[model samples]
Target: MNLNFITSQISSICSSVWNCIISLDPKVISTIVSIIALAITALTLYANTKNNKKNNFDNLFFHLISLLNKIIISSENNSEKVEITLNDIKKQNKAQLETLKSQKIKEYYEQHKLAVNSRFVELENMYLKIESKKLEKIKKSNNTTDTAVPIRKSEFLSPIDDLDEINTSDRSQVYYSYYQNNTTDEALNYPFDVSDNGIETLLRMTSFKSNPSLAIYNIFNSDGGISQFKANINVLKSEYPQNETIDKINIELSELFLHKNMNIPSEISEDMKKDIVNDILLDNKHGSYFRTVHRILKIILDFSKSEAVLNKYCGILRTQLSERHLIILFYNAQYTDRGKKFKNLVAKMNLWGDNSELDVGANSDAIHFATNNLIWKDKDLKILKEEYVRK
Candidate 1:
């Protein structure tokens, strides 16, 4: 009985009513009313169908668009979240790598520091053993009573007085003489006639023996204890008459010092003189500040040379050479009466290792070598100020 059946029945009734009305009392008005009612019902049915179809299409279209938009938005959000997650992972990895790098550097420094300390200890033990053996040999010779002066201490002392006459540049002449004169197993076994050279050679020799007794022999003769082999230096000069090797060493050192410091008449600079007065005359009461300054100057001169051997032993840490640290290194090389006190402080504070602190407040007279001041004065001044304040 849906809309179609009802509309058909109404139309049929309207037609019948029209005919009835037409037949009765010449009713033109009734026939017109019935015709109008049938027309209105047909129009109503057609309009309802059209509106229902339009509503259905509108709802379907709106729902389809909403679904597509939701999918697109979800995809974009997932992409952004994924990107963020990946970035976080990358950042974490980078942080870990940096941390590991720092740790490796620290560990390497620690190992090297330990090795140096151990080597120093070994040298001390060897020195003690050699002294004891030498004493026993003298006792066995029964020459103890004949000895003019009783031995006050071991021949090898902490530091020997600076021999004004001896120069490293002249060593080749000494070495060549020892090589020529001494063909004995003992002499040939030693590369140089000096005890210090011997000790240094022994430390360095792994498979080959260059000079076994160089360091010990130097120490023995230079210590003012032994009279034997005192003429070794002269003998070496005689054998190598030309002394070409010694000249070469002196010339090389001279050139290096001059070129490195950018100063004039480089040969004059090569004659580095360190005043050891403060060290030798050190008193217990008041301190000598001027001596420290002089020692610092000497260190500066030594380090100014292009081929300074100390830098080579410093290894990678050498690259971190700043003016302040160089001053500290100079301090380390200086001969001072206050060395024991300072060294004690350094030992207690772990100053030889990672926790070491440099006297940053030191005067930066050495900085001119590292940087130019004319163009970058402001920047250089700021850095200098910061270093100067960090004692």
Candidate 2:
């Protein structure tokens, strides 16, 4: 017999023996005892299934705890948060363990930056080439004539140019006049020195050869000529107590009001006019700077017409034709946005009658205005569009 069957038979026999002892009737005891044994076997099978299920649950819980700890550590390392249900934790763990790529990408970025730097050098070289070509043209045109063409100032006007020609004595005259008009109550401290020529000296010292573009760039960007000029005027005012020069400058500024259909106000003082003129004289050559002086003076003369700043300056500067036109051109170079302003300002100035040279751009200012306006014209606007505008 099989061991299991034999064991079952033995249990039945032991039950039969016990029933016979208790009842003293073998037939009745055998039936009741067999039924009880069958019932006990069924109970045993049920208990075994329950214990197997508990063991499986304990193993699963431990596996989930280990996975959750790993996920928490990973999120901390990356400075990010992650949440996962027990079912998905296994898949997420597999994914995170597969690769480490952040360092390789950083190396690639460094290489890309080096490439960009190289390209920048190439672009700079191209600009240098363009400059060299321009120098070659100038050299070719250099001639033996005694009345050779003077170096035409570039379309952009630089104040450094004006400072070159104006000597110490001339600047002193300007400073003396400036001081006399500004200082009324204060005592004069610095007399206009006849020997000091700071403006001229600075200009002589500046060289356009070593780095032509950089030199020009530095001049335009430094001290904003107009603002610096105004500062000097203030310095003069603080030093010189009072003088006739202030009254003269004021009278001249007031006269500018008479030309316009405006009346000079009485409240506008002499000091104010001098200050305004000082500001204008600073840029000396900048159209906007002059324009500012012309307008401010006009406003003081007539408060009601304060909004007429541009109109007044443009109108006045436009009428007085001279080297101012060249100054206007230099200003135009520095401020390309003043194209319409340049045109309007120059148009008002008395133009030469027949000489076409003086007609379109008689001088520097005209050239500055003509170049900007011509390129901005409806038909020829294409070429300069990329240089100045996005659309």
Candidate 3:
């Protein structure tokens, strides 16, 4: 209480004494009244001290609650921003795979890649036209016009072979799956002996007679084959203007096959270099969010001697998280050094408790687990998910 409040209480007590003095028969003698006044003053001072402590306690408590709300809001907003950014990236990746061009797409991807990849239809049609021509040439050269239902064998439909089975909705998923699997765990292993038969001759297939696309591609790529193939492509590119100049790639490949050094490609494109550097970044701006959570935990842990208050607030934190937020948490805790403290704190509190299944995600930390050489027999990253599973 302030000085004025204490003074008013003291004055009210004195006024009662004055009234007693004014009575014809005093309520109490002066000495007794003085002693009673002293006792009342002592009680008033004690009450004020207790009130001050209560006010301070309440101030800290309300401040803690306010901070808790702010942390929760920051987490939600950060998670939403991360989700939006990831969705935009995924859409862009999907669009680029589909060869859907815009200013942004044009800027990110090379024009040659868009041209070569976007027109798989034309490439397949060219394959068919060449196949028909080859059959006609054979018949004319033999001088035989009697062929009953001649089967046009097309085991070489590269573009639509796998794509024919997948629906449009599943195309992106299938394309990416194949795209990601293109890389091997180790370096390139050349088949047979490239030195003995020329690297190009060893790699390319002689049977793909109608088109030399595979032939030229085989020389250059086998996941970026030997340095000689790149040199050969560079030599060929001088005459072709572009290695994959879509208009006459078949012509260039046809020329490539004429030499004993080159044959049909055993692999797909030699240049499977896709850029995704920026997508590796764009993170959750929630470092402050986690720090604040730690402070809240500390406050709760220090609030009482027991674990009751700490568990209560941990429950509060768990309830605040969405599934997306949980995914974010799983990534941070399992992968990042900075998130270790928060992870330990939550684990200690049994934050997920019996609801630990909420923390258990499907391959949520797969990359981290793989990178760390963690075996699946050891539970992988899922072990971390059970950190707070109740006993």
Candidate 4:
């Protein structure tokens, strides 16, 4: 009896629930379904937007890091190229700061700033090392000329020797003392006039007084003398027979009228004249000796007749000499107090513009410019301190 009553009640309840759903408003049910569907769509859109932004930021971040790594690996010899790449990355970083508004990226950059700075320093250090090695090689090459036996004070000498005797000891003392006491302040104050020919100007600018003409004579008068010079000439002629400059040098030197005392031939070709000149100026074995002779010729030769020849010779010599002097100056700048000041000037000038203000674009530009140009003028330093430095 209880089972029958329970079954009838369950049937009546199910029929009542079915009748209620059938009698409900179709519009209201449709509206409820629509709202639920709309909610789900909104949630999906929001999730996709968020993910897209994160992905964009990540792509940019990794790309910048990759550029930096490439610079570290391949930009050893080309600082200018590195500066450009770094600037591009900095621009991207600044853009991220503006658009993505991601604190994670800023944190990432801060953490890696040291690494970036160290890499740049490493590049510059590598360049300095290479340049130093090159200079050492040149000095060693010159030292080969020292094989010439020392001439006695009584040997045939010019008035310049008398002057050398009087100043040699004093000049040496002054040079040594300057090396010991050289300060950054003094270096900064030291006048460097770039208006004159780079060689003469550089020589005059040095703290030590040296006579280029006398230096050349000493090399020319070395052990084997003129005979050894002729042998060096012959070797160079054979080695570079077709070289135009060497031929020209040989022709000019062979002119009997040009070197009446030495009895040089009169019928030499212009090509041989150039070749002879090249032997003296560029031959590795006798180049140092020839360089000295060239310098002496500049002093004694009739400028009117030899002007064209001398000009060509000087152009090559100047280029080579300027490079050597620049390397030396760069080396000195690194080790001297004056150099430190120069470096500080570079550092200050290079800092992100107005460190306190945080202008990413401007700062990026400054870093690029500073790293690219290690040497700065007073005007540049002044502008950097006044315009870019944090008060």
| Candidate 3: tens digits of C-alpha lDDT, residues 177-250 | 11012221122222222121122232333212233344234434344443544443344444346436543654
Identify the runs in model 2 with alpha carbons over 4 angstroms from their true place: 1-21, 75-391
Off by over 4 Å in 1: 1-111, 144-391
lDDT of 2 by residue, 1-391 (tens): 6999999999999999777678667776787779899999989988997778656644553454344334334433111221122112224333332221223223332444344233323322332343345435645764434432222122211222221233223233333221222122122223343322222222223343333223322333346532432343343344343734433433432332231322212222334323333343342333333354333333333322332533443344333333333333332322344343433433322221112222333344332234432312332222223222111
Best candidate (score: TM-score): 3
| Clash count of each predicted structure | 14, 9, 4, 26
- True-structure lDDT of candidate 2: 0.35
Q: Could you give candidate 4's per-residue lDDT for residues 103-207 as a string of tens digits?
A: 432343344445433432332233234334433454455443423221111111212212222222222222111111212111221122222111112223331
Q: Return the TM-score for candidate 4, rounded to 2 decimals.
A: 0.20
Of candidate 4, the 10-residue stretch with the lowest lDDT total is 177-186
Query: Which regions of candidate 4 deviate over 4 angstroms?
Result: 1-26, 75-391
TM-score for each of the candidates: 0.16, 0.17, 0.33, 0.20
How well does candidate 1 match the true structure, expressed as C-alpha RMSD? 32.7
* Candidate 4 Cα deviation (angstroms), residue 260: 56
The sequence of per-residue lDDT tens digits that candidate 1 reaches over residues 1-391 is 5999999999999999878777776466767778899999999989998788657644653454344334323543233432343244335444545455445433433444444334323333444354455445545665524223122133333332222212233233332221121121222222333443322333333211232223222223233312222233333344456656434433332333232332222111111111222322232111222233223223332333332322332222223333333223223223344454443222221112221222123454222223231112333234334432223
Residue 25 displacement (Å), model 3:
40
With a 3 Å backbone cut-off (N, CA, C), the pairs that clash in candidate 3 are 204-264, 205-264, 214-265, 221-270
